[model samples]
Target chain A: MGRTLTEKVLGRKAGKDVRAGEVVSVSPDYVLSHDNSAAIIKEFRKLGVGRVRAPEKIVIVLDHIVPAADEKYAQNHKSIREFVAEQGIPNFFDINAGVCHQVLPEQGFALPGLVIVGSDSHTPSYGALGAFAAGIGRTETACVWATGEIWLRVPETMRIDLGGRFRAGVFAKDLSLKLIGDRGAEMANYKAVEFAGPAAGELDIGSRLTLANMSAEMGAKNGYFAPDEKAFEWLEGRARRPFAAVASDPDASYESVLACDLDTLEPQVACPHTVDNVKPVAAVAGKPVHQVLIGTCTNGRLEDLEAAARILRGRKVHPSVRVLVVPASWQVYREALASGALAALVEAGCVILNSGCGPCLGAHEGLLAAGEVCVSTSNRNFRGRMGHRDSEIYLVSPATAAATAATGKLTDPREFS
Target chain B: MSRGAVWKYGDDVNTDVIFPGRYTYQIMAPEEMARHALEDLDPAFAKGVKPGDVVVAGKNFGCGSSREQAAACLKAAGVQAVVAKSFARIYFRNAINLGLAVLQSEEAAGALDTGDAVDLDLARGEIRSAKGTFRFLPLPASVLGIIEAGGLIEYTKKRLEREQE
Candidate 1:
């Protein structure tokens, strides 16, 4: 009768023992929103609250359509700035900060043993740090801002145990794509997924974030890895506050358990229109691509940039393909610059955009045209996601994206390495 | 009883198609968003849908992204409710928070077809059509309370007023 990590976390927040299917009201340590803050502001106004209950608990980052794509967006940004200043909300990142998912962890807000909610579905990306983070709607977020409380149903836990080591040219993105493909997009709907086992432990923080970030694609309420030495080491200097890690009990109950062996895993790609329409890179190799995007909250970390750089060093991109490199945050951008990864990418004819979510959600920067195909390191391949409805997106790892950009087609990363 | 014509779709009808991400930042007004609802998935949906029409789809309806516009647009466009085999977690919450009725019934999703006339009884959790009738689990009282109040904003306002009283 042991409790899972989710049960333990919710129990602490609820001030009582809770079980799956039970709804409890609790105040989250942080509630995040980005460009959608404009809409949230509207909803908050409708609530007629003079001021937010707890401004410190709210985090706003402007990365969706950074620097204002047009007059309308600029007005929205202006309103947000005014609202942030008036409400005395301390945590606010403007256009230069980068994607909210990366900026939250980089600023040390995503701590273990805390509850966090955001207005974006990928808000669960923070669960990689062992926090119980889930995505909520803008209206719910506005309510949280007004009252400082929100209700959540304790979710059933799904345990995914990853074993064995990944071969060269295969990465966390490949494993993530494989899992979604095998289980389909709705595999973990409304459930919490805990990644465990040897391979999960061996993955670096960046890889863990990639897995947790893509968990949204599987419709998971949240996805997380137990905080271990690696997680603690990553948070050592970055974490703003001290936190105690949470872990599941030895006999914690799980709705189901899935065992994934990484030994034979290969580079994988999600084809046009859906994230779960995945195949081995070899199966779809030689499909012509017009663009290659190598950054976003999904694969826009320093390690991902270095992975692409290793492949693109001293090599020019295919003349027909336009390669765009975006860092996840200013911190990652600076680190890549210092490490010469940016130089390698730039020298290889890649367009290095600023640190933000560039073209991942099709808000701005690097949108595809009709009949164009893009090999992207970012997550989500839904139709009309990046640009024209006729344009297609192929989701791949950074190594695979780089290889595809170099060849102007969907090429396996193994060919480059 | 609430009745509407069904607009049928298949599995994984994601938010990107329901309300394209390209308009996520550009459009703010709910009415404006209504113009783009399902424009990518089905161009005729926005123009043809009446105020009481319902959307029927297979598994994972409203999947992808946490944009409330996906539900808000449909609601603005006069979508009475959405019937699906299942729903993505965040979108389910978004739909309720926006006061949009969302029902999950494998029976209803499989039985309903495009252009079918259907009637829904919220009080009894029954969906009746010419083909037959399907029952879905009744929503929890707490969720019903939110919808009854029109949305979370009104619910919160009432709660705040009660606290002050």
Candidate 2:
């Protein structure tokens, strides 16, 4: 009866041997709240508490609405800034910081073998480095603010084994969309997914970040890939703490096991209105689009920019198409600029925005108009996720997004390759 | 505690439709969010829903962002509870923490229809709608304690006060 990675991490925090199907109160190593900190602060005040239980352990980031979209958002940011200053939360990343997922790790707050929770759903993005991260609501976060602890039901583990080699231009985004397309709503509900097998090792930390971040779309509580050399390599100079590397047992029990052969997977896309409404690029090709967005927490890393630049080099964006490239973090943006990736993109007529969650949550920047069609690399494509509920969104990899921007339609990356 | 009625929906009712992201910036209060509850999915849901009305849906209700507004809007819109075949993990926690009753019963979820009369006994994990009588698994005792305490806020407030005492 070996313990799964989730069981071991949670059980260690709970100070007892635990398993799936049990609810236990566990103190988290790190808790995060973003621009929603404004709303969370409102609830925290109502909890009748004068001070936070563990202010030092909490992180507050401002990436949702930078420079404040309007007066209301500006006020929200102002409120959060005041809360952070008043509460004396040491780990505070303001507007210029970038997305909390990237910032948390870059700033060395997220660590392996820790239980991390955030107010936003994609907080599981930290699991790319083997942390047990999940999302909670603002009110629940308020409770954590007051008490410094939360009770979470240990979720059953779902093992997704990725094997075989990936074809060129078929990155982790394609594999993630295919997995959700084949088994979305039911398989991952209330379950934590452990991505195993050789293919999991094949992906770099950036690709792993994309896979873990979109695990939210599968209804997963969290998704994990065990810490390995790649994880250490990425965290080399950034991580401040010496973490105990954790991995699942060789014979750990799982609720279900799914297999995906990377060799056969193709460039994928999630159609408008649903994360699970996925399709292969060839299946729905030739649909004209008005815009192409090439960044977000999911695919806004330096490697993602490099991949897009590879496809966009010496090619101009279609006259009818609008392409926007946003890096995930300031670090990534700086590196992309230093590495000439930004130059290639700029030469290709792509507009490079600041490093933030641009146009993903529809907070601001690159918003779509009514009836416009957008090919994006963000996580969700729900109605009005960008700007107009009537606008259409197609989820694709950066390679495909760059290819589509060149053609002004849903073009396959292999065609450009 | 009382007999109720249902408003049915099909599978995968996402949070975007439940509480659109467009309102994330504009609306802050629960009542303000309630005004647009399910507006895209059904324009009249906010106005049509009455207090003590139960929402029944198929698989994966509240399946989108970690927006508490999805559950808060429904709670403010007078949805007594939500009974679905299943729920997204994050949404399930949000709904419960917001003090909105949520039950998972495949039999009850598939059986109910729009405008169907229903009755519930949350303590006993029992449901009686126009479709039939069905049973759902009761939440853990600890979870029930939070719900009984009127959600996380009330529960935490009690703990804080008792610790002070």
Candidate 3:
């Protein structure tokens, strides 16, 4: 009879008690779109609507392909600006901002007990703050922008309790890869995953964000971690409004319960062609790594960058390995620069990119040629994810990535220190 | 009811292959996207596609990333529907929102192979192929409503008119 966090939050938004498998309509707190806003705007125009129904509930971010890769991309950006100007929409973050998911929480658009939808899959990144967020298509986003309301069939809940403490060199990324590997990507399809237990609470907001961010790769509708004092501390003055904390009842409905023991887990990697194709770092050790990328929406936070910097400092990158570092947002980028993390990375022969989704999506920045192997901290390792189908990508933690760059092979980070 | 030849894909056929990340930078229209639909996975998909064709695949069709362009490209490639063992949550919703039909039927996915002829009765939630006839759960009424309205654009347009009224 108890309710899950997904049920509790969605029921409140729907103005009634809801259950799994029942379709309900509700107004979300905010809807987000990034560079894809250009595509969304085009679709909105096709609907023959003159203005956005609720501009305030919509936040637009221009991070992908910033500075416009070419005239086509530049034209897309131009139209987005025109749309924002005509609609007088606030909360429009230009190219200098960061990824949409990061910018939303950073600027206070993401708050506990709220429902947020975005045009990007990693929208669940906000769930670390106790908000219910998920990715929707551009057309669905257009609908949310038009009416501020969306419909959903409350997904079943998959409760994963991360218990025990993490050993040295083990991180949220390793745990995430472990979960995906163990459960497989589609095990939680059409389901919301709620993280609980001691280890989940002990994680910093950044690490929690990493877990929430990779929920997309696990095929989760969204990922939730109960908002406790740590989340409140992170949102101190940044939360848009005062929100009553919400949590699932102790006996809440769950499709299944999984206990992820961090004490026994080791550094993990998702090998070429599939995220769930996970392997322990030692299994793939000594494989040649031509490039090492240590930043992305999933792992481009201050903690991740700082970890990579600490490992790479006073050590030159392997001559054959190309290292690239990209901060998730302008704020993170500035903070990393101010704190000298960027300097350490640069001195170690890493190419520091602007605060944009660079090679993660394989949009020309840091692309891999045929037969090349890259050790990346980004989420996916699908074939052709980084460019040529023959090229390969190995997903790793930032520490392992930095260590790999230094040695030009899949080396564990703990060995370096 | 409709009949079409199927182009089969394996399990976990991700969005990256259906629409490569290399093209993410190019802001192209749906039709433009169709030109390269599944080019990375099949290489012959776009040029070989015909209107009313269907894509049959194993488990987890259209997994990875929230890009709606994957569904849009398939729709633009004249794919009438996609039948699979299962689907990633976002891809399933995106397909419905973009006016592309998708269904989950383990039997259909397991029996059908590339170039097989399929008789699909979408209204009745049945797929008849050379192997056999299999049934799938019909999409919920709400999703059917959006599909009948020709996707979210038209659905939202009607909603806007009612709001004004």
Candidate 4:
């Protein structure tokens, strides 16, 4: 019997053969935490561990509420700094680095064939690099820090084979929304999803990140793409250490297989209140939007900005709309600026915020008021996610967000194309 | 055995609604968080919930962000156990690590309604109510050990002490 990527990775780490549903304790290659490190520190202290078991394996990034949104957040950051210094942890990215998901990969910490766990649910984003990445609770993270190992249940694998090219203006975000819509939020619960097939090769690293990041929305433990030439090329200069990429055997068993054709896929939008509440761009067309945000761990890369800039170049944003562009990391920000994407967006009346998680998680920056509607490229349109409980958020692609910003309503990106 | 009144909810009751994201960065005690538990979903949940009350919900309960506050707030708000048809993966671990009981049984989730009285027997993996008796697979032994030890913190402490000895 052949082994799936997840079983292979976990089995290697465990120093023995493993299978789905078997719990094994193994030390992970990397463990990430963000602003939640403040809370995690408290839990760590309770373990009475004077020093972290493996400081090198820990990565901390402070970007959830950058520059300290208020006194409370400021104090949290202060404690985290003191903890980092006291513990002598070397891999700490201060406020300016950007979101943890993007920063981890950009800093060369995410590598293939490694088991990575983090405090944030989107830690699966690293799976785009062919790593076995999963999210765990803060207490579990603290325990890992204390013991240098954690238990994991090898998840059943779900194979999603993507074939055919996407239509113009329809990208990976659309495909992601479509998948989540067809399979409800709990469709992949306790499972690992592997993205494969012909069309998977066409997606760039940024698009792969979007798909892997949104895998959390479908209750997946992790999502991954096999490391191909593009992945190896992208990691050549960024990987901190040499890694042996892992892949599923040709005949590996899967809990289920879903085949998706991207040729006819249209722009998709996750309606307000639920990520699975999805509809085609045309279904919700003409709904007025108060704000249009294009950024987050899901879609805040340079390519995302360029896609938005393509639609908004030389065009003014609607008078009733406010467009905010947040690059995923400082590196992406510099690249986008050099590529003229930032210039085009700014010239079109879009506001370029610093490279941080601007308004994706609603910690600060661009909060919405009651009765307001926002069209955002970020994932999760849950009620009160970006501000007022009554405010609405429609999740769309960067191009769709830009198109909506131009018209101050829910508009399809294909219309502009 | 444990017993409580039921506070029922529908499918996909995400962590964002259990504890709003706006308070993610705010440093507050667990008790204070209990005040805002489910404020957006049901304003009465915080004020009316009594100690030992249980939360029953449809599929995909506690879905969304991996913020531990979602599980913390429910534990702080005096929820004895959560019975749902299913739970998001991360939240299930958080609940168990916090020493909160979580039982999965579609039969109980469908039969229980708001205000229904119920008894949970963790040892027998059964939920008894006026509707009837529903059986759920008990948590694995390793997981049940953590809950019995009053969460991961205490469990880790004991392990460290044993190692040092």
Candidate 5:
């Protein structure tokens, strides 16, 4: 079998023959835990792990239920705080630290040629920086917590080749939705998804991150981009240690390869209850919506906000629709505000949520009631995915969502410009 | 011989309702969690579930939340194996790591009713219930190893012992 990006990383880390379905252990460059998953720390106590193998190798971020939405949640953070203090884990991001994946890359914790694991599914969001990031369960999180390593099966790799350039109204979110639709959710199950092609090369790092972040929704184990100049530029300000690069060899073979031509694609949406229910914007053009949200770890970068702002400029939101804009992190929020994107969105009557997963997790804010409809840029819109179990959610590109919010109907962004 | 009482459930049961977000922060013993397992979808889940019963669900069982609490609760509730058509990625890993058996089979999921008595063959990946015998797709070899070793910690200890030996 030819080496895949996932195999190369796991093999080097394991220093052995890594194969699918084999029980092999490999050290990770970083292990991430969050407030919702800090309960693992409490479980770690039961396992009798003395000191964490390496505090520097671990990252703790408090995002979910941050600032303590309830007493139960506050106590959860308190326990994580206690564990971090006891273990002397040096890299700790608290309620004020912003989203974990966002801050990890921002602070130089993620680097190329390293394996990163987090407690959340969206942890794969960091693959844009050319690292292997996989989301594991809490027990696996605990195993990593105690030993700084965990077992993995070297997954078969599937190559997605992007060609041509995106049209004016299309964005990375549309492309991702299109992939999910063409290939069912199970197509990428337990596989490494490598994205390559001329269109992929033209995309910025943030756009690549958007593509890789949702690979989890397709049931992929790892998603990555090859290290390029963009990766170096992303690492410029936050690193001091020199790192070796890892990439697939020229003749690396893939189990399957899919080619996506951007020039032929249009804005797309994933219908209710399934991310794989993909359709073009023209198919759902006149669908009415009750809410429009434009953010998630996938599309919550400053560029996404800028795109939404560009569409919303000089226009007011429809009376029937509520628009919510959430920046993925505090830094992204600062960039948006500095660039006047925030002003445009606010003037257009869009509600700006804090820099965490506010309405994304069906938490305290922006929840939908029964029978209501929402066009959101977030990943996943399953039953009760957004808020109420009965509400319908239409997953769309940020441009489509913004334009729909402005028009109170599922209008195309091209309609405005 | 089967070791305990039977507790049963239907198909397509998800991980979120098994262990809701509200309890994710609480490290209450698995026993405490068992009391709340499936509370959202079925209020009587805690009361009716007994040790050694198999949960037969349709496709995509254990579909949400990376929290192992859902598995911990099932184990604490003493579910011997989860026989389903399919499983979400995180839940399958969590179940094996927690020493809970998850057997996948479309036939097994289709044949078993909520309260049927069943026998599990871990090695063969088959479930024998009153409805009939259904073959479960084998788990990944790594996961099967962990399950046989009685979860992650024990497997680690055994590996260290062998290394020293």
Candidate 6:
């Protein structure tokens, strides 16, 4: 029977021909755990799962409660650390290792034509590498721990094609914001979004990852770009096994189709309260900004840091505007620090934050005060999402955010350079 | 058991508010967390809610976050059914996984109001209120089976047990 990526991955994992809308037991090539719910070790203990069904499939990382803020957070990490030690899980990254999504593909745990599941929503970020990844609950994670398999319903595919070259200073972040604004967040719920056409092919793997990572913000099951030579180059040094190059057949049908020309695109921003409340940057130009953040698993890659560093290289952040920079992972951090990006940001008076979610989830640092305005490259601008319920968040590309940080007002990157 | 009392909510009542971001790190005491359900939107929600009530909301409900705490809070609050115009995919699965009953009805989301007494029939996908009877889009057999068996875990357990037999 013919199948889509979701069905193909699930079927191969299950050792059977999995069908859409049918429940089938399928093993996952990779399973991920984070500190937020590692406490489920107790639940696994009660479930009587003996030593995890497949230890090699387990990929655990310490992310959510990083650096162990307190005794409780410390215990959360301790629980997972003990479980990983006892079970002999093959892939375990401590807090220094970085956010699971960033480091997973970085170290080559995620590959094309595989199935991966994490205990966090952004697990879909791995879709950029052409894998099927989704977030599941703790009990489901426990079940996966018991049996490296899960049941899945193959989702219909949605095709979004872009064919033109982007305008100056327009980044993938702006393109994604344009998408979410045009279609609304739930437009592609429970569906796969495949990117194609000239513009997508021209984008580097890092930018593609930024686009795929935020698919969750729009409620997509996963977003994928077919495996390219660059992907092979990325895997050459890391992975041991052969990977299949997966893409839709030339004539593949889509449940829906959306097309945009990159040449006509503009730098966009998501207005306060909703990721979907999007508008072109020109509409909100000159708006006051209290803060600007240039990071998150979404845009915290080396390219993102380089973009911000380039804009802030010879300038200081406005005294009234606080700017925070967080690399997606420690690897990115060390690379930036070595390449002078970190020093440039520090010299510009930007707060260099740790490589965790921070401010993105409002759990750790960088919460906005009442009525304060922030321009960030992070996904999701939901109300009070960054901290104060009344505080407003503006979502922009990394370049725009850096430029805005230096100016203390919403400004486009093109205007400065 | 009779379908319990129904509580109503407006549309787009995202997963973040159902279970705030601050509490995701501590998910063991889901019931205690329920005390703050919708507290961001309605400060008195925890006090106003009673067991077996239903929550009805507008379109694109459960829009953000995949935290199971959202469903866990609804389950802890003893919410019997959630009828909305639509649900975000992960939240839908999480609610079903946690044994919380959720239904979809564009009309029900439009007509229902807070404090209105509602009786929901899971099998029929019908909502009966003093104002009138409203029909909902029927649940697929799979989702119906999940709800009947008390959620995904229980459903999976039942399947596993039956397969063994």
Candidate topping lDDT: 1
Between the candidate structures 2 and 4, which one is better when assessed by lDDT? 4
Recovered native contacts, candidate 3: 0.91
Q: Worst 10-residue stretch by lDDT in candidate 5 chain A? A: A16-25
lDDT of 5 by residue, A1-417 (tens): 466667777788899756554556789998988875566765566565577778888888887666677777777888888888988888888877576767787888777888889888777777777788888877778778777778777778888889999889998898899998997775677788888877777788888888888887777878888878878987998864576778887678788899989999888999977788899988888888999988877778889999999989899999999999988788899999999999999999999977776676676568789899989988877666566667888988888988898889998788876
Look at candidate 5 and give me any clashing residue pairs: B11-B57, B11-B58
Across residues A177-292, which tens digit of lDDT does each residue of candidate 4 receive?
99999989888998999999999988999999999999999899999999889999998889999898889999998999999999989999999899999999999999999999
Runs off by more than 4 Å, candidate 3: none
Tens digit of lDDT per residue, candidate 3, span B1-165? 568889988899999999997886577777999997997799899999888889999888999888888998999999999999999888999999888999899989888888998888987789988788999978888888788988888888887888789
lDDT by residue (tens digit), candidate 4, B1-165: 667999999999999899999997786898999999998899999999999899999999989999999999999999999999999999999999998888999999999999999998888888999999999868987787788899999998899889889
Tell me the spans in candidate 6 whose CA falls farther than 4 Å from its real position: A1-3, A14-23, B1-8, B143-145, B155-165
DockQ of each: 0.89, 0.74, 0.84, 0.88, 0.44, 0.50
lDDT of 5: 0.79
Shares of reference contacts reproduced by the candidates, in order, are 0.94, 0.77, 0.91, 0.86, 0.41, 0.29
TM-score, model 4, chain B versus true chain B: 0.97
Q: Interface-residue RMSD per candidate?
A: 0.9, 1.4, 1.1, 0.8, 2.7, 2.1
Cα error of candidate 4 at position A86, Å: 0.9
Native-referenced DockQ of model 2: 0.74
Per-residue lDDT of model 1, residues A316-390, tens digit only: 999999999999999999999999999999999999998888889998898889999999999999899999999
Better of 1 and 3 by TM-score: 1
Of the two candidates 3 and 5, the one with more favorable DockQ, higher being better, is 3
lDDT of each: 0.93, 0.88, 0.88, 0.92, 0.79, 0.80
Q: In candidate 1, how many Å is residue A199 off?
A: 1.3
Considering only N, C-alpha and C atoms within 3 Å, which residue pairs clash in candidate 3?
A: none
Each candidate's clash count: 0, 0, 0, 0, 2, 10
| lDDT of each residue in A182-218, candidate 6, tens digit only | 9888877888788777778788888889888888877
Docking model 2 quality class: medium
TM-score of chain B of each: 0.96, 0.94, 0.96, 0.97, 0.88, 0.89
